[model samples]
Target: MNDLALRGDNIVKRFGAVTALDGVSFTLGQGEILGILGDNGAGKSTLVKILTGFHQQTSGTLSVHGEETLLKSVDHARALGIECVYQDLALANSLSIYHNMFLNREIVRRGPARVFRLVDHKQMRERAAHLLEDIGVHVPSVDLPVERLSGGQRQAIAVARAVHSNAKILLLDEPLAAMGAREAALIIDLIMRLKEKGGLSIIMIMHNYAQTLDIADRIMLMQRGRVTYEQQSANTSVAELMDIVRREYRAMRATTAQ
Candidate 1:
């Protein structure tokens, strides 16, 4: 339990008359990447929202770094070393890379407080440059506007921002969605590098079984609001996942026809 970075037990969520998540449970070990796969309406988005503290579960329990937690808000989660990067990346395209890196967490001069606080631009720039370099994200300069970067670069910046905030458990929502092959490769390589570093735990809510299998240490498949399968990535193949999904859908169709 102590080595676990995050754990969810029998989690359930509902929106009035509709149930979104039903009895979902999982564990994320320290320095592990767990890929969560599911189709539309399978509660993937709901689960991610709950995990990131954007939404609360109607029932069940959540533990962060071995302590049961009730994450009050997104900021609360961030304060506890949990960060999330959604598909939009939440970047300010007109802002310089350094400014975006700091965002709401900008460093302020020591002498000032509140409304008079002065942003330490030079310090932020220096740290952003060093951080990008350390994480293998290449850009011409920290002064460049985020609009000048490519999709992969933007994605990397979003991820780097989470890392800069000292995230221990990262929730990634469709990190590679709508990317071309080369762009996807960039994010994939970055994920592998982070995994090799061995401190952060990640949960990627994904659609592509094969990509998730390639990148994650373990895989969990959800269907109609419940976890239907869980296995070590090394022991599962893409074919097996596809077969299981097919069977599940067929059974659902048969039940509907009866």
Candidate 2:
């Protein structure tokens, strides 16, 4: 029970006449990285939303940390130690790194009255610096504007923010998207560092098969709203994954022509 962080049993989702997910099931283990691979409409985002409490599963059972329950809202998910860092990174470019780390979750002065609140910038800065350092993310200063940093740096900051919120389960959407080799390597290292730090489990919605295989302990491939294949990363190859996708495409083409 403690080994599992999350599990979904025969999950389904529908929007009007369109079914976004067709009986998908999966599991994420504690302190393990699971890479979800699929095409554009393979229900990856929908599953992510459901897991993060942005959307409810039409019919399924979801368990978080051995407790079978349905998440009510993003805050509910957060209360259960679930957090997501979307691809947009969602950082205010004009704000400093420390400010972004505490975005919408700022620390207020301890003795301030309800109506007279003031942000504790010094505390946030020191804490943000410590967190970043602990996570192996080194930057010039926590006071620098986020826009001044590189793409990978921005991504790291977003991840750090989720961690600062005390996330036990982290979901990353397209985490390595649109980055050069060096930048991608930076984030990969960060992800590994988080795993090594202990007590954090991650699910990455990814497209690059090679990268996923390299980073994930296990891999699950989705095709048109269904999980078609799943395997331990160590046992799978890029060639085998491409073969499975090709077979599915061929079968679809045959059905369409009939």
Residue-wise lDDT of candidate 2 within 42-78, one digit each (tens)? 9999999998999998999999998998998888999
Give me the overall lDDT of model 1.
Answer: 0.92
Please state every model's RMSD to the true fold in angstroms: 1.4, 1.2
TM-score of each: 0.96, 0.97
- Superposed Cα deviation of residue 157, candidate 1 (Å): 0.3
The ten-residue window of minimal lDDT in model 1 covers: 109-118
**Poorest lDDT segment (10 consecutive residues) of candidate 2:** 109-118
lDDT of each: 0.92, 0.94
lDDT of 1 by residue, 1-258 (tens): 899999999999999999999999999999999999988899988998898889999999999999999988998898889999997889999999999999999999676453578898888999999999998898999999999999989999999999889999999999999888799889999989888887899999887888999999999999999999999999999999999999999999999999
Give me the displacement of residue 79 in model 2, in angstroms: 0.5
What's the CA error at residue 83 for candidate 1, in Å? 0.5
